[model samples]
Target: MTTVLERSPGSEAPPPSSSPLTTDARGRRRKATDVTMRVLVTAAFLVALIPLISLLYEVISRGVRMLSWEFLSTDMQGVFGDMTSGGILHALLGTVQITALATLISAPIGLLAAIYLVEYGKGRLARVLTFFVDVMTGIPSIVAGLFAVALFALLVGPDYRSGLMGAIALSVLMIPVVVRSCEEMLKLVPNELREAAYALGVPKWLTIVKVVLRTSLAGIVTSIVLAIARVIGETAPLLLTVGIVTQVNTNMLDGRVATLPVFAYSQYSQDALGVGADRAWGAAFVLIVLIMLLNLVARFISRRFSIAER
Candidate 1:
């Protein structure tokens, strides 16, 4: 049986509680623990942020001096070490072309695979594919570069370093990320949307295309952006597959090409106190700016699509 307590008519009401919680010992201990965890989490966040802030500061402070208009439009075709007059136009273009190619190659394949996994996968084949993708995700990037080189060498002679090869290598790194990220995004689409479309007698494929993909379009674009960023900053793969060039070459199937990461690596290779070091820092800054611009583009696309969806 439940027991009830009664209050006397002449007695004053109990004092207001000191907190949202009761003032018992257990409550007090729980509040103390909550405060302790909040303090620790805040401290950890600040600690993690310190390195990022320091890195940005150092890069911007050092790089801004050399990141002039001329520095962005010229290449070191005839210029030698320690001069640092040429721009990185060729390298910049190569980076854009190669990365775009990689994105083109990986995005569709990954998206389709993710669609299959989310919409139709239900058997052992899906599990095996997922396991392999997980394996690929952890594979060292250099291994991808090597595999690309070997594959191309078998088909196109032993000396096969090209922008196309670099893109292929980068695609190997990007596909798994695209698949995983797109899978998560696709999963976020509400089942109600799918069911409602199906109840309207919509074809399964049409429902997925119109309802599922459209609903998750924003997240899909964001995932692509993430995949691009993840691969754009990698150096080892490009170094082996793309090599380096001082001249402009827009052809992906042709000779050596330069990219921002490779450009920065080449610049940093010069003597410690030389102008090359400064140029390297500038290249790094430009790279960061390019990434920021790409992110802006992705955000714009997402917002535009979201508005249309609305």
Candidate 2:
């Protein structure tokens, strides 16, 4: 006997199967969205790149003519008026000396402080120290310069202007940056490594030195380089503390010194239309090159020396 199956009265028709047309439409929408996002991101990148390309073009076009062995070797001691018979030797020397001094002064202190904050710090003291570091990070470069000037003036004399003082000012700026960057880098280290070191009966300090610091060494170096770049181009602080001199003076305490930024400013201010302007542009080009070299060196060091996982 043949039996007829009956459907319930309240039962609705089964849902239709998904169609290829609907699936294709949804895939097309996704593709369209992805394409739109790519276009937007590319447009943004090109817009950001425009200014940098323009700046490089302007600097290179104007400054390339003035860059020479003579421009790199000679000092502006006797080159008076629009003579244009001088180079940035003195400024370059001062920039190197003062920045090196500042690094020497700030690096150890900042690293130690960061270590303390990250490893051993607890409770109210750590909070206070962190707060102070945060405040210092936002302190104006001019204020640091003034503080250095005032400190030296009170200790030595009112008219004391030297590269040492400029170094001190830069140290103030560098310290906060170093501390903050180092703190973040140290924090990025895994706690598992610390625990493993502890499980092996290693002392806390030894573990930090061997495991934590080693793991973060590359980042720490990068942070230090960034701090150097931040302070190297500062004109106001160096101008106030180091002052400008035509001849090279290597003594940090005896007399004024010239830095690239200060020298560029002085040249442009003194002679905007002639040889000085070209010299100023050339100094700027040199400064940019120096920063680029420092970054490259940092990258090399990071790659060569940083701990690698097996």
Candidate 3:
């Protein structure tokens, strides 16, 4: 018996190859989409950086000449007018001291508050605290300074102003930031870690401190650094609370302080040209450098902690 191999009309011959144009069209579409996306993202990034680059260029160009050792070491205590005799010594010192004090005062309190909100929060109390924290976060820096002034004046006299006062105001601003950042970081810690700790018979507090905080320590540090950064450049609060002086006062409790922000303000506002202008630019450069250094430090710490975790 002979078997016949019959095929349908189109199937009688080998199937036709896919059209090259259709395949090419799809490939072209995908390529175009990818290129378009890349171009858009790169353009957006460059646009965002333009202002930053311009500002940096201006500051460095104007400020580089004033970065001499003598300019950095001397204070404008007795210098007057267009005389360029003093450096930012007093202002730099006060900035460091006040910011350091503010960080010390804010960090631990914020960390604890964050822990409470993340680990133990449940119900109405947490909600109330959260609402208050959100409110505090939005409070203006000037308001914080004013509040600090009013509190200190009420306690001491209406004539109270000191580096400590400035620090207190900065702390008030920093605490809410730290709290919010730390709370978010803590929430990122895995539930499994907590469960494992519980399985191992670890106490609740120990689990939180060891398993949770250690897991998110890098983020916490970064957030605290952010809080520091937030307040470091605030001119209004420091100006109001610290009340700048030409002379450096190491005793934060007793005398007015000269922070970089306030120093820059005083220089620029008092002298828009000549030596004062130069000094203002110089102060601004130093401030930018300080902030950059802090960011570098935070990056280093974050990397170190992350590596240790891994």
Candidate 4:
């Protein structure tokens, strides 16, 4: 037991011990990499933000000068030439009516189709429907306008141009977007919930109505709002279908009607300087504000429903 062991000459040397300096250098290297990555990500974000900030600044600065109570309350019925005493009431009314009609037409159809696709669809029929929807989604806004125009001309008369026609055109553009978004939202619902409902003797339709739709209500609303936003700014469809009018026309089926986009286009085209240009900028500003309000409303609804679900 008193004898001590010794290393032979042919044996390998013992491994070197790690030093504090080596560990510290490794840690510093890792920290440096993390810092570099963070800086790069932040720089990228700022670069992306530059365009948006610049756009907002330009629009707000140019457009804010023309905004007033008078500009929003009256119509361009009598004001002509270099006269600056006109408003966009008619255009605003037309936009609201046409867009609302479009929503009414598209929302139910889109929601129902999405429900079928998500809850009941199967086999080849579903695939065909999906394919058609994909095709419709890519259809140009101008083509939708022309299609509506042709359909109306064939059904009614070749001289027809009305807010209803514009609504029809917008609905064409909006439905596919609604369907896609609603389908994705409905798919996000858990299967376990559906199964639980079924186990309780709930019918498939009732389960979809009560459990599935209620659960995804917020998302559905959001999708609808997004669809509305997508079509609301379109100029070609409204220009072709709704036409231009100076006075307010509440009846969507009657005569010509002006919309915000068309109004802006007409004004800008009439005169790039002076009163017409001012009116154009004002209309653009108003449209932007309207969209912002819609987005805010959607967010509020989403938050409320999310809280209710919790």
lDDT of 2 by residue, 249-283 (tens): 99998799999999999999998999989999999
Q: Give me the displacement of residue 296 in model 3, in angstroms.
A: 1.5
State the local distance difference test value for candidate 2: 0.94
Which residue pairs show collisions in model 4?
A: none
Estimate the TM-score of every prediction: 0.93, 0.89, 0.90, 0.89
| Candidate 4 residue-wise lDDT, 76-109, digit = tens | 9998999989999999988999999999999999
Clashes of each: 1, 0, 1, 0
Per-residue lDDT of 1-310 in model 3, one digit per residue for the tens? 9999788777656689876644788877887898999999999999999999999999999989899999889888899977869989999999999999999999999999999999999899999999999999999999999989999999998787788999999999999999999999999998999999999999999999888998998999999999999999999989888888988799989888899988888888888877888899999999999999999999998988873657
* C-alpha local distance difference test of each model: 0.91, 0.94, 0.92, 0.93
RMSD score of candidate 2 (Å)? 4.6
lDDT of 1 by residue, 122-141 (tens): 89999998999899999999
True-structure RMSD, every candidate: 2.9, 4.6, 3.4, 4.7
Pairs with backbone N, CA or C atoms under 3 Å apart (clashes), candidate 3: 74-87
Best by TM-score: 1
* Candidate 4: regions farther than 4 A off: 1-37, 307-309
Kindly indicate the candidate among 2 and 3 with the higher lDDT.
2
Candidate 2 Cα deviation (angstroms), residue 32:
5.0
